[model samples]
Structure formats: C-alpha cells, structure tokens
Target: MQSAIPVSSVWRRPVSPLHCRCEEGDLDLVVIGAGYQGLSTALHAARAGLSVQVIEAGGIGDGASGVNGGQVIPGLKQDPETLLALFGDEAGRRLIEFSAGTADFVFDLIAREGLDVEHTRSGWIQAAHTETAMQAAVQRNRQWRAQGADVALLNPAEIALLTGAEGYRGGFLDRRAGVVNPLALVHELARIATEAGAALLLNDAATSLQREGTFWQVSTRSGRSFRARKVLVATNAYSEGLVPNLARSLVWLHSFQIATEPLPPDFDFILPSGQAVSDSRRIVLYYRRSADGRLVFGGRAPMRVPQSTDDWLHLERAMRRLFPMLGSMRIEQRWFGRVAMTPDYMPHLHEPQPGLLMAAGCQGRGIGLMVALGGVLARYLAEGSREALPLPISPLVPIPLHRFRRLGVAAHLAWYRLLDGLER
Candidate 1:
C-alpha cells in the first residue's frame, strides 16, 4: 500500500547528532565545520593514522557543500593566460594543473571510496549566451584542450539540441566534469570518516579558539573544550566570530534552486545529454537533471533568505523561457544556500595564527575544488609541507567596507541584469 506522504528521491539516513569529545589528551587535529573540506581533511588524516576530530555547528548537509545543485565544475574564474600572467610561469602552471583535474579527482574518489552518492562524469556545459561569449568559450576550449583536457566546442545548433534551451549562440563542454547527489556525498563522507576513527560532533559549535600551552584549545557552545596540535577552520560562507573578522572577508551571496517532481517520461529530452549546464552570463544560469528525472534549475537569488514568492519568480520565468514545453510544472522544492565569493574569484589559503589554518572562497565552484583540496590539505597536514599547495599561506584580510556589501550587491545585481538585457 502506497503511503499518502510523498517520499523524496534521495534517501536520507541522518547522522546521530550528539555532543562528543576527542579521545584523550593532545589530539593531532581538531577540525571546525564538517563541510567537504573538513570531512575530507578528517577522512584523509584518519586514514593516514592521525588522531582527528570534527565539530559541526548544525546537522550535516546544512551548508553550501550539501545544499548545492551538484555541478562538479573544474577550473577557476581566471583563464590560463590570465593566470599565467598573474602568477608567473611555475606557480600559474601548477594552479592550472590543479584546477583542471578537480572534477576527475572527485569522480575517482567517489569510485575509490565506493561512496553511495549517485554521480556521473559525462560532461559539464558552459553555454554561451552571446556571440562574444561564444568566442570566449572557443578560446577556453582551445586552451584546455592544448593542456591535454578532454574539451570540445559546440555550435548554436549543437547547443540548442544538447541543452533543449533557446537563444544560445554556442558553448563549451568539459567531458571531465559531471554532477552528483550533493547531500548524499556529504553523508557518505561523514559515515566513512567516522568509521575511520575521526570523531564527528554535530550541533556543537566552536565558539572560541585560543592557545593553551603548545596545543590550540577550541571552546564549544556546549561548554566543552578540546585541545589539539593543529586546527583546520573550513570557511563556507557561514563562518563567524570564532576567528576574528573571518566572515567579513567574504562577499556572501545567495544562490537559490527549484526542482520539479519526477517529470513524465516524455520530458527526458529536456537535458538528453545528461550533462549539467552553467551559462556564460554576468549573472549565470545553471541547471541539471536529477537522478530521478526532475529538472533541478537554479540561478542568482537575493543576498538574503527569501521572504516571499516574488524572490523566486525569476527562476520560473527563466525556466519557461529556456524550455517552453512545460506550461506549468509544479515545483516540488525551493531552497537556497550562501556562497562565499572572493573579489578576485580565486581560492585563498590562510594561516591567521600559529597552528591554525583556514581556506576561503569557492565562488560557486566549490563541489569538486573543495573535495580535491582535501587530499592537498591532508598531505600538507600530515607531512608538514607547503610545496603541493596551490595558494600561498597568508593572513586573513577583511574585505573593505563589508558592512556596506548589502547595498552594493543589490545595486550591482540590478545593474548587471540591465546589462544582460542590453547585450541582447
């Protein structure tokens, strides 16, 4: 007998969130935040035979890592030539190599770990919204291909046929990229991390960090104090007071998504290629097909949480504009998550105090980058070497006038929208 209540496509077995402490004195590492970076770090550290622990403020899948649209895109906001010019020959080449392989790295890990996250490495699209955008895509495809990446160019006809969307001039596709069940990935990581001897404490926020003798002491909201030889602070746009203005350093923006219930069988042609897409617009449009055949569409949202339906009307309009076959599909889910964007659109590694390390700035490309970074971080932590890290360690510098970012972001979004219209 079918139950009256509808079940979600992705099955959930929530982790038992309880207050737990590390095992005994002077642990090797105490990680704050249980997002991809923290989980990856703990898993790798534990596998390496290091004593480690994780402290999460909320339940798993509460941050950007879990709630995202699951697009595993590789590369940074900068192109190869620009990166080379900015950071010279050696460093730029290293950064390029690291960014290019993030997606493959993530897919390999999923297979290697036997993670239950449903995923594919079919490809990822960068739809060109304008002729100029097409030219840029062409250049990007050429650059990556020359570096031995499996990338290709698509014509207007190919773009329209592949995406089932209107008004795309051309595009680029990276065959190494793909999509995943984001929350499922996080849950599996948590499960495996705990099984590997990394203690995970959920709902226990790290409220304070201070040095106690040689070890760094982390004080939690539950009045529990943990001491460790090192600390990893994973920044996911929700960081705050624990580390002195760490939150202000990022430009936090909201990216929201709406998903339809499993569509009728005939709608399979909508994204028949089974590749996730993000277009080349100032305010980008990204969408994908879920494992259960729902259309999971997403785009720029208000800087804050939605207070009314008006905040999401733009997505519906855009969806209908792209794929007009559906007159009125009922949206089964509407959700949003905060993204920490850097002004330069590059990832940063910081060491604010002795024995404390942190990473910031995902810029909407967090999925694969953050996961791949885990091995980098784990190796660095285990062996005490900085040679493999892409970004140099630096002090956390707050973004200037972060208090006024609300007004600036709102105004800029409006202006960018107007500019997008003018381009057409």
Candidate 2:
C-alpha cells in the first residue's frame, strides 16, 4: 500500500558539513538508525558543536517509531513500584522521574522546534475491564497524584460518559498524556536535526564496525564508511544482528495496529472526551481517536515471528468487542512492528565497548523514553557523566534460551490470549 503521506514531503535532505568533507578522516559521532532516538542524538550532538552523521537502513521512521499505536502515554510499561522493588528506592526514583518527564520533554520539544505534528494534550484514560483492574487503576492514579502528577480517578459513570462504552468499570485520566502523528513527529525531528547542521543518510545501513585506535570505523552496505570518535547504536529493534551479544540479550515482541476509516461526525459523541484509552490486560489493547476522527487500535496478536502478512483477524475481533459502533467501518490500514523488551521491561543503555555505546530494549515505551534517552546520551557525550541518563547502563545478558525466542514469544502470546479470554 502507498504511504498516506508523501515520503519526500515528510523528510528533507541532510546538511553536508562544509569544513569537513565526506572524505575527511573522522567525525565526532556516527549514529545508526534514523528513528527518533538516532535523530534526536544527532540533533543534540550537532547542537553541541560535534560533527555528527546518522545512517538508516530504510527511510526515516521506517521502524517502530513510525508504526506504533501513537498513544503518547506516560510512565514505563512496567509499574513504577515494580521498578523500585527491582533497583531499590534511589535508582528507581531516578528512573521514575526520568520517565515521567518524557511527556513534558516531548511537548517542550514540539514547542521549541515549532513542529506541526498534530500533537495534543487531551489526556489518556487507563480503563478497567474488571473490578480488580478498576481498583488497580484507582490505586495507580492515587500514587501518581502523590508523586505530583495531574491525574484524576474516574468513576463508572464518568467512564461511561468519557468513553461512551459500558465495558469499562472505572478508570483514571492523566491530562499530561496525549497522542501524535508519530511518523510526522519523526519526520519533523529529522528536518529539525538537518536544519541544525546534522547529517542524516537514508538507505545507508551499518554493516560492521571496527575500533581504530581512539576512533571507530563504521562500514555501510553502500560501499561507504564513517570514521567517528564515538558511535551510538540507536537502532532499537532493527539493529540487524550488528551486535550479536546484544541481540541475544533482549526479547523482541511483535505489536500490531489497525486504523479504521474516519467515522461520520455523528460518531464523535462516542469519544467526545478525545482521550487515548488502554486496558490493563497482560496483552493490553490500547486505542485513541485520531485528529481526523478515526479510531486507531492496537495490541499484541498471536505471532510466532515478525512478519508483515500475519493475520489481523484477532485485532479486528478485539476492536469489535470494545467498540461495536464501528463494526461496519472499513479498516484503512494495518501494520506491525517489533519492540525490544527486557526481562525487567525497562529500557537500558549499555557500554558494550568503551567509546561505543548502545541504548535500546525500550519494550513498548520507546517513543518518549527514546527521546529522553537521546537527551541523556547527548549530555553524557558532552560531559563525562552517566548521571544524566534516565535508566541505568548495565552489562548485557542474553535472554535465557535465546535461540528459542520465537517459540517463547509464541507461547507467551498464546498464554496471554487465553488469560484475556478467561478474564472476560
């Protein structure tokens, strides 16, 4: 299918360095992947007066960054309490503060860059499908408010009024959360980075890397090489086997989305609140109303491996179950993407090798976390401080039974689907 938006109109050409030609000996930094993380890092480094270059195997935002659910939800996928238990109070608070600042950072960046990506702060609703889930939602809202967040608990009647659906028992609303045209945001960031004097190379894939004394020589498939003092692997899920040690450490899960055609204006009453919504299931279903009044829904579907043509009948069924008002609406688009997940479900930055840094394993919270991580990486590069980073940099450890990841993911999906059905 053709892109809804033109590619050329979305991304601009990168700016070539004037003083240092392409044949110059080395650059200050070479970022792999043109997704949000890489582009943000390139922008930050170039803004810091460093010669930076970004290489992407495909077009900008061709990966998960562009194809996600587009719900700019706050906090990590795993609960903040779980994080505290795992890393102790101090580190956990640092992680929570960094993550919670993600939404603020995104809104601030849009304002600062003047990007027209259709960003809105209409808020997000975390609904409960069961009584236990409802209690969890209320508790989460209370905890977030205690931590100084602007959040409110919605009773059953409030939920019905906000969602126009009787399925949700209760929920909470966070006005700081919102949605965006993710592809548009990525494209705007790429443009802003280029305008800020950063070089971004599309269709240039990093094939291999070698440490050249105090510098790094990164080779690309297009018979090109970049010599940089430091290299950041912000490839995320599309790392393409570059770092075998890292590839084995994380579990990549496939998440799929389906967007319906813009509904009639009469249907606006169904989602008058314009709040993005998500449930608390293990394989949760998250959805939001688009600026043009389309319902974009997404969730984890049963999949043995990552493939474009995997059947989406399950997602369609789920959509019908949640909002039967659009049962007859045609699906305008369906897409899938893989998100890097850690056992602890937290994003991590790894110093796999000195001078060569890797930051990924964002789970499903990559959008905001990636931006925050980029800013942190920029600060770390500018100053000799890892303290600026939101998440801790730890040693890479391969997921157990790495070779059977596909089977493991399939089993996990089946179990979650079964659990969702049982709960219903």
Candidate 3:
C-alpha cells in the first residue's frame, strides 16, 4: 500500500544515482538488499576505492530497515554470560564489544556523513514487569556495569518517575542507547553511498547467483547481471530464496508497530529522562519518543507471515497497559516488518559458498547491528577471511523442522501473551 505521508517528509535527501543502471562487465563487489547493511557496506567499500554495485528487490529501505520501530539499542540479543558459557570468555568478550560498538559506529556515521535524520542520544531503559524480572534486571545492570557500560539499577520510585508508569517494579537504564528515524537514516546512507561512487539499483532483485571461476555472477529478474569478484548477501528477512543455504539457516517472525498522534506536552513529565523504554518479556514491548513528539511502540504479534493490517486493536490495548494515559490517543500509523531469528538468538555471518558471504539473523536488532555487520563484511571482503569479523561466523544450519517455523512462533507468542496476562 502507498503511504499517506509524502516521501520527502520521511526522507530528507534525493534518491541515490546508482538506483538507475548497472554497469557492464565485472565489479569489485555486488551487494544484495539495499537496507542499512547493504547501503553501509556499499558506502564503506566504495569510499575505500572498490567498484561496488548494490541490487535491491524493492526501493531503498522498503524492507525491515525502513519499517522498524527505530530504536538504536546496543548489544546483542544473547546475554553476555550465556555467550561466555557457550564460546568461552575471549570470544564472548569480543562479541559483546562488537555489538556495543554498533551504536557508536552509527552515531559516528551520522556525524561524518552530516545526514539530516533526527537522531537522539537520550539513552534506553529496560523496565521490569515483575519481581523476578526486576531481579534479573539488577543482575544484568551489574554485568553491564562490569563490562564498562554506563548502566544503573533503578528503584521502584525511580522507575515510576522515569517511565511515568506504576506498572514496572524496577529496571536498568543504559546511557549508551538511543533512537533514530530509521527510514531517513537508510535514505541518507543510500545517498551518501552513491555520492561515494557506489551504484544502487532499486527494484532490481537478484534472482540467482552462480560461481564463474573466481568471480560470482549475480543475475536480476530484470535481465540485469553483475559479475563481481565478491558478493555480500545483506538481505536479512527479505532474502527470499536468494541463497538456499542461508535462507534455511534462519526463521522469520513478524514484528508490528503502531504510532500515536503527537504526544501531549504533559507527557514529558512521564518520561522525564526522555529515554526509550522496553519491557522485559518474551513478547517484549519496545517504545520510544520520536523527535516530533510522537509515541512509537512495537512488539511481536501473532501473524502467519509478513502482512500489514489496520486492525491493531490488540497492540493498542497492549500499549494502554503500559501508559493508561495514552488510552485516548489515536494511532496515526500502523506497520509491520519481518525479522530473521536464529535458533540461538545470535547473528551469524556465513560463507555459505566460496567467495560469497551471507550476513543475516540480527533477529530484531538489525538497525545498529547491520552497520557493524557491514564494517565486518567489508573487512572480510577485502581480506578474504571470516576471522576478521568481530563476531563469530559459523556455518549456516537451519533449525530442525524449519518449515514449521511459523507454527512454532505462533505457539511461543501465545505462551508469552499468556505469561504477560498472568503477570499483569
């Protein structure tokens, strides 16, 4: 469906020039998917003097990158202690450091590129919905603090004052987190990438890929093709059969969002810290204040696949549970996007085939992670070693009975919803 908002309203810059044509013959790199990862990779590679060409199935940021809730949160989905237990201390520390740097890298890029996207570094809070969760938040704060993260464990009074809600028992606040206008950021990045000499081809889907001696031949449905020495698949959830190996390795789940009309000025008293807040639940609720004074909230909803519907009554009810004062607020916009989730919740960068790299499975945190992944992929493409990646790159392995992922996700969501109800 066409958006009611004008394109220029959300995107500040002009379309990238590379979205037009594909050059003849071979290129240094061909990137699939024009989301944040793809755009960032192209920008960094081209700026480093490589001939880069990016192909997108749809318009720039039309995928999850543009449709996300725009929370620029830090760290990976997996807990650091769990990572250390699984991969040992050294690898776990490396993983934590890499994920944390994602937010820093994003802010640095915004400043260096001088993009007009509304970025705010007001920090983020993880609110506890139950006593058990509150204890966990305290432990998490301690862990993060030991790792040099500027995190604090807030008391119930502080939580109530910060969130403007009495529902949360307590929580942890991290100053390293923030928010952004994701779509605008992607558009600006695409423009900057083109300015740096990278070619971006929107509406050009990479239909197939095959190895041609040392190079990879990537062909699009529009009869356009790119013979590149290196190809990076940054498609995320919209990978859509581009690489069978990589596709099978990840499961797709839909995350839905609804934004309220510009918040009343008095709402500031509720969020005195002016930070983004998310509840600690399996079916988590993440919400933040937009630069325009709107409350944008989102969470996982039961859906068979990626589809948008205006029937967001369930999500609105969920929002009201957090902020009863917003019960009368009108939902100005409703949207949904698919996220690629791995079995272990950790993102993977894989060399599914020789000379072809696949980076996906950011779960629902791709905004910050994708930029970091781009830097990792660029280094790998230039150096010819996955070892250069800050995070580990393991072989792609699909979840057992992967074809039934939707059923599994639906059942999980149902259980989580029940838990949320019980807690309430």
Candidate 4:
C-alpha cells in the first residue's frame, strides 16, 4: 500500500575492498561464499567477538540469494507431517517450532539492523492447483495449527478474493510470511557484518582447503591464503569444485523469473493484499508484486543459465494462464538462479569432521531459514553445543551416480510436469 524505499539507494551502494590486517593466524573463522548463510554466520560470529573473514568468488549475493523469488515463507521445503515422519516426535517438533518462527526472526533482524530492504509482512498464500491439493491444504492447515502455527485454509471464494484469480481451487494463508528486496537485504547484511569487524573478500574464490597444524588453511584463486580455527562452506548450488563431494550431495536445478512492467493506473483487485503466492505443484509457480507495482512471476526452468529474455517465455506463459489479463503485459526483466535440493527436501547441516561445518540444500526456502541457521551456527561455534541446534548434524550423503545428476534431474522435472498437467 505504501511506496517502497528507493531501490537506487539500496542496490547501488558500493562494496569496499577487503582490507585484512589479521593475516592468517589471528583469524578465528574463514567462511566460504558471501550469500545469505555466509553473511548471516559472519554477522553473528563477529557479534560474538570472533575474527571472521568471508570469501566470495563473485560479488556479494551473486548466487541464489540475490535472484530468489523473495518469498519469506516459514519451514523447509518438506511439510510438517513429512518432517514428523522423517524425524521422530521430539526432533520434528523442535524443527517445526523453529520453522514457524523463521519469518519473525528475519523481520526482527531487518528491524534491529535498520535495514532499508522493502519488507512487507502482509501474508503468503499457498494456492491449491487442484481439488486434491486443496484437501491437502486443509490437512496442512490442521497440522500446523495443532503445532501452534497461525495458518488457515481458504476456500475458492476466499482464494479468488485474495489472489484475484480463479485458477486456484483453494489455498492456505500464513500471516507471518512476506517479501523483501532480496539483493538489498544481502547487501545490508554484508555491510553490517563488515561494520561489526568482519572481513569480506570478493572475487577471492577458495581454490583449495587443507589442514595445516591446528588451523584450517584456505587458499584462494587470487593467491591469498587464510588459516582459521574454523571453516564453514556455505556455498549451496553454486559450489563449483570448492569442496569435495559438496556439489554432488544435492540436486541443482535452475529457476527462472520474469517481471512485468508496472500495471496500469486502473489496475486493481489483483493481489491487493500485497502478499506473495505459491501454488501446490511439483514444478511450482510462485509470484509476488514488486514495490513498483510490477508482478514478479517465477517458476522452474531448464537446468541452464538463461541467456536472454526469450528464456523466460515459459514463465510468461505460466503467468498468463493464471491471470489472462497479463497476456498483453510487457516484460521488463528476466533472470534465473540455481537452487539446491536434498534427497529429503530439507536443509542439511553437515559436520564431515571437527572444525569443518557445511550447510546447504535449502530446497527453495532459503531466505529466512538460512538467516536463522546462521545464528544457530554462531551459537555452536561460540558455545560448542550441538544439542542446542534446531537441525541435527548429519554426514554429507552424496547422490549415487553423481555424474548423471543432470540427466536424473531432467527426468524428474519432466515427470513433475506430466503430473501437473494431469491435475490441471
């Protein structure tokens, strides 16, 4: 309802070059990758009085963190019931509670840091694409409500009223969910982390990691090296040969999104609540309106980086199918990013060995969860208490026949599309 903060002010801020006086021995932590996880962990670790340094192959937020759909939904990619089934009652209950509070944690961080990212806590809608899906939404509403979540099922009438579209049979709404300028948030986090006495090294790709005496030695492509007591590999899907068996442990898929030009002045009653919407399809369709009134529509794409606007044509078609009025809208921007997926569709925290920690496989819900996990990691590093973590530490389980993962992912995508078409 209110105009967003000037994007130029947030997105155009310059990143200062890395000036590290700590050399190698004095560094307490060396975090790889400068996306949400790395920045969040750096911020919390620095706040806890650790000498932290973050190394990014590209600029900050140059990974999925910058190009995400920006929907701040709680919980993991797997639903509550599934979590309970995967983990037992106690662990699953803890995870469910943590998931429920993810949005609150993110919003509070944004406020405490005085971040200018366009944050809106209007709500989020999990639209049901089929009758069976709507029934499942009811079940989810009941499950989460029983677990103390403020969620509700919306019938078709309410769905139409909320989304301004008749394609969805029904949906579930979570009031805690919202959206933000993801890139802006990333920049602000990096800024605050550095301001609180952390070093950020951009264009410094980690070339090799080794154990040198008591500290972990991390060598960079720029020929600089840092040795720290602890090392965290937070590079999710973009981890190209940085860590052994890291990229192979999860399925990497491409997600593309396109933004429309600002709607006409007369346009109204379309997502008037200003909430984000995601539907119940294996290859899901998610969208939300930008602060400037452009509808940002996004969904799954082929497993390749998009080269031009034409690569987003399928996304545009998907948007038109949901809201025919958008058929004639002009496309203003197109982009794609890789998202990681675990076998169980849950974010994994791995401790392959002591002094080495890795967190990845956000499975498309990384915005809030990554921030919260960062805090958990900080606590673990500071207090050395793994029992206090919401997520249990597990060994990295690399996918079988890892080299054929691309072909496997393609087949899975085709199967999901077939299933979605049948439901429609």
Best by TM-score: 1
lDDT of 3: 0.80
Residues 37-109 of candidate 3: C-alpha lDDT, one tens digit per residue = 9988888888778899889888877788887877777887766787788788887778888887788889888
Write out the backbone clash pairs for model 2.
none
Q: Identify the runs in model 1 with alpha carbons over 4 angstroms from their true place.
A: 1-21
Per-model TM-score on C-alpha atoms: 0.95, 0.92, 0.94, 0.94
User: Model 4, 205-240: lDDT tens per residue?
Assistant: 899989888788899997888989899999988877
Worst 10-residue lDDT window for candidate 1 reads 1-10
**1-424: candidate 2 lDDT, tens digit per residue:** 1333322111122233222123345888888888889888878888988888888888866787887777777788766787788878998899888878888888889888778787678888988888999888877887788778889988889988888765778898988888777877788778877877877788768999999898999998988988998889987777668876788877777777777888898887666878888887778888877777778788886544433433667888888887887768988777777677788777778887877888878766677878767887987876758778777778978888888888888888889889889987
Query: Candidate 1 has what TM-score?
Result: 0.95
Candidate with best lDDT: 1
Candidate 2: residue 182 lDDT (0-100): 84
Scored by lDDT, model 4 comes in at 0.83
RMSD of each: 3.8, 3.8, 2.7, 4.4
TM-score-wise, the better of 1 and 4 is 1
